[model samples]
Target: MLKIKLSIFFCFLLSFCFAQRELALKYETRLHTYLTFKGSLSPFIKITETDARVYKSNQDKLNDNPEFIIAYDEIKTFEQLVKNAPNDSIEAILKRKGKTKWSKKTKSEIQILYENEDRDASENKPLSGKRILIDPGHIAGNFEMSVIEQKYLRFVKDSVPNLPVDSIHISEGILTFATAQILKKQLEEQGALVWLTRDDNKTSFGITYQKWLSTRKQIVLDSLLECGAMEKTKYNKLKKEDEKTFFWSFFRDHELANRVKVINKHKPDLTIIIHYNVDEKNTDWLRPTDKNFCMAFVPGGMNVDALKGINGKANVLRLLLTDDFPLSEKISDLTVKEFSKQLENQVAKKTDADYLKDNCISSSKQGVFCRNLALCRLVKSPLVYGECLYQDNKNEYLELSKADKTYYGINTNTRVKAVSDAYFNAIMQFYKK
Candidate 1:
């Protein structure tokens, strides 16, 4: 009976030993430590030909690991020493490299950490970091988004006397499209999440200006039904209302309304509205008082003016911009200086034929030169709207008619880089917190 009991006891001990595991660290270099797990860390693990022999002091250098050790660095197998410990637990207490040491909870902490990338993409949102959104003002063409000079313009045979060949005046749609092209490429190069509301800047989007305006008008009607519809009380909670973007007509209110669409869409750090201003012969009645370049915009901060006089304002990000009277004044001041500097450089330094491709403006015999850089208003984010250049001014207008790098300030596709660089730097300063 006694002999049979001893056999059974011995078999049970063997089973427990089989379940044990061992963990070992092999140091091939000061920077490299190889970690391997045996079935269990049962104690002093054996060294094999695959393992190198090292000094006893080296064991001390290894922090006197409580789970497994070389014992004498000559043995082979943990059976030599009687120790039981969880390999994972000891891992929590190991040293990382020469200068760094693992924390007591390293195993738990490491397991808790995960590098996931799908988070933002699944929501169609950008990861939290630097993001830029650009709106190039125009597109290609003669009334088509890519083809300008068609939609907003009508050419009649010289009904008057002798007016040489038929000539074309400026097209708002074309100017918008062109600006968007320049704006898109420039900001993208600087790594921004630039997007355009329309595929191309102009052309009534394949419809007539009247049709386009009609659609835009409808957008305004839709906005009134949205949360921005005028309210007597403070903004109602968004969950209780359907917040939406509005429209911009030739009306200042409408123009500002367009900016709101992009703001809510991009949630960008800054917003810049690109445009070329018309001296509008009405300058007599509507001249901006400022000569710097007819630019206007709002500064950035908590409340969003894009929401306007609505009880429920659109959700403005931490930083918001607007064309309120104050913001318009401040941005106008800075824009004039910035645009003037760029125009002076474009006209004088990069005015060669090829350089003037995107910028076709030139001086006239009348001294009425077309100076580039008109009115642009950045919106939603630290906004600035720059005219970029005057289309009516002979010299400035001529420069803009070319694809020349100098005329566009960079390239035909996206020349707003100079401006983007300035804006980017400003944003970094603005949102440091």
Candidate 2:
């Protein structure tokens, strides 16, 4: 009788263990199919019955060593642990295990999770007590800056027939900022606390491009070299190169990193990155095209190369364990729907853009894509990177250049206000869900 009971207990334990292993495998398969760009097993990531491991390279995997490991049971705790730790603390942990260096933090603060339950029930506002962050796309302050950044829409007189002006000069940065300003106001009226990543004409670093060159350029270059991101020869070449080269290669990414830092530090419930789209076929944006579409990006599409870095691996682990990815996709889907309806632009198909086909994973939602953009991957919150309308379309250029309205001294067209309303409606619908 004792032997029979012992055998039965052992059988039960075996079945439980097998069940856990099956669950882990199923989770990993889902991640590979939905999140990875190629939908294949990454050489840098390994999954066993009990845990997932992230390796620095194939050599590390072969050697049975990993830089980071999180047990299947402890993934939730690990996600919370990362949220509570400061960026520097997290970086220190990653640096000790591998060579991936994160961007320097401007300041360290313990992120406080704002619970919706804490809001007063008596509040009448639709988005009462919600925190939101808006990131306008680029740092082009004027036409000159936009030309330098290559985000300007330029066309000679009579490019499209009935012209509003002799020339069309539409800077994407200006349009995005204006839209954000209007959106911020709308959100504020609904009792949501909103923060913009930068003021008008400024980078995420809170300064103009010229100011960053004067102050922080050399220091950033030195840090990049120390971290092995810039080779010594390349570093030397960059020191002597013109400002345009620096802006293109170094300043742009650095500013984007700063934007991520700012958004994460704010610890918002939702983040919105606003940008006006352009025709990918419209090379140099010197003229215009008729192609117009609306789209939004959520985080995913990581390849093996992206998985090799410590930060990338950590972010992937977070996405796999947390609800951030799903929430982002849901919100983005709603926003894209609203954008198409309001702007009267078609949702982008997989074949609409080359980069979308090459670099992004199509989501189940029609206009929402999973792309590994820096802001999409690192913001640590549910986000929508929205591209509202094609600024380089001949009709769009004329409409966008109208300056029919001014919000907070930012001159924008009536179309921008409509875009803001689209975003506002999306947010309302998202919270209702």
Candidate 3:
């Protein structure tokens, strides 16, 4: 009897060890396949059976030393560490582990439990108590602002044969904001709490570009320089650059960071980033193009150069350890499917755009690609960065220019409304699953 009991105990231990090894293999496979853009093993990250180590560079790995070490079971604690010490180096955060407010709770802690409970209780309201965040890409409010941001579709009268409009001067930002507003309303009507990152004609900073320049520009530049995100030479050049250069450079990335900050703080169950696509080959967007395609981006696609910073490395680890990657893929897949079906646009193939081949990792899903976009990497929630219909496409431009509808006092076209409906349907399907 004693021998039999000992045999059972040893077998249990062995099986547990096997399970752990299998899980580690699974994670490593995911890391290489989905996260690494080049489909090669990253030099900065080393994974073992029990823990993953983040190295500052290949030299650190050669020394067999890591900057930060996170055990498999301590993923939740590591998450808290990063949040509490967003500016601190990963090594510093790990060193002061016990000093920080660490929690042993799982990733899907109180908030998710409450969301599930609310979801269970509200059968009639499919999205009841769910939180959704809508990020309208870009800060341009009008044609002039759009021109400054270089995100507008422009064409003179008769630029394209049989063009419906006398001229086309549509701002991508305006379209995104309109689409986000419509989607927010639709989600809210379905009993979800929705938040937009910015107001109409405004930026994620809660102000217009002009206002930000007048009030916060110097302060932001100083902070960027101090943080080493901007070099001193670049900071000096920015002071002399025109407003357009400023918007294109520092303001752009900082605003995106602001969006990420707010979205992470909101802790939304899902995030939707809205943008109108344009033909990458359409230089200057001076005229319409025959190309129209739909695509969606999720996290991953991190190259070697992308892992230069502590924050970027931390985010990569977060994505690898958490369910964000798979969930993002699912929702993005659904979104692209709906966009193709509703808009009568084809899902973009890897061959459709050069960037799609060179800069992204194509997913198994038809139109979903894993691109290392700013919001894609930093936003903590499962998100879909949607590039709907191409704004520079000939027919799409005419259709999107029609001011046939208005929602909440915002003027938008039927095409934009259709895009909103596509997103709404996708969200509904996501929740149904």
> Could you say which candidate leads in lDDT?
3
Deviation from native of the Cα of residue 280 in model 1, angstroms = 4.4
- Candidates 1 and 2 compared: the better one by TM-score is 2
* Distance from true location, Cα of 22 in model 2, Å: 8.1
lDDT comparing candidate 3 with the true structure: 0.82
Candidate 3 Cα outliers beyond 4 Å, as residue runs: 2-7, 39-41, 80-93, 97-124, 222-233, 305-310
- The clash tally of candidate 3 reads 0
Write model 2 residue lDDT over 239-358, tens digit each, in one string: 887778878877788789889889987778899999999888888776778899999999888766556455667778787767788889889999999999998989999899998888
Report how far off residue 268 is in candidate 3 (Å). 1.9
lDDT by residue for model 3 (1-433), tens:
9999999999999998998899789788878888997754477787888878878878988886786767877776565545434455444555544223335553334223323323333646889879899999897888889988888887776556566666877899889989998899899888898999998778888899889999999998899899998899998999888899888777888788888988876777899999998999998888888999999999888777656566666778888887788889999999999999889999999999999998998876889999989899888878999998899887888777667778767688889988999999999999994
Please report the TM-score between candidate 3 and the true structure.
0.87
Model 2 regions more than 4 Å off: 1-26, 39-41, 47-50, 59-66, 91-124, 158-164, 222-232, 406-410
Of the two candidates 1 and 3, the one with more favorable lDDT, higher being better, is 3
Local distance difference test values of all predictions, in order = 0.35, 0.80, 0.82
lDDT of 1 at 220: 45
* TM-score to native of every candidate shown: 0.38, 0.84, 0.87
- The alpha-carbon deviation from the true structure for residue 56 of candidate 2, after best TM-score superposition, in angstroms, is 3.7
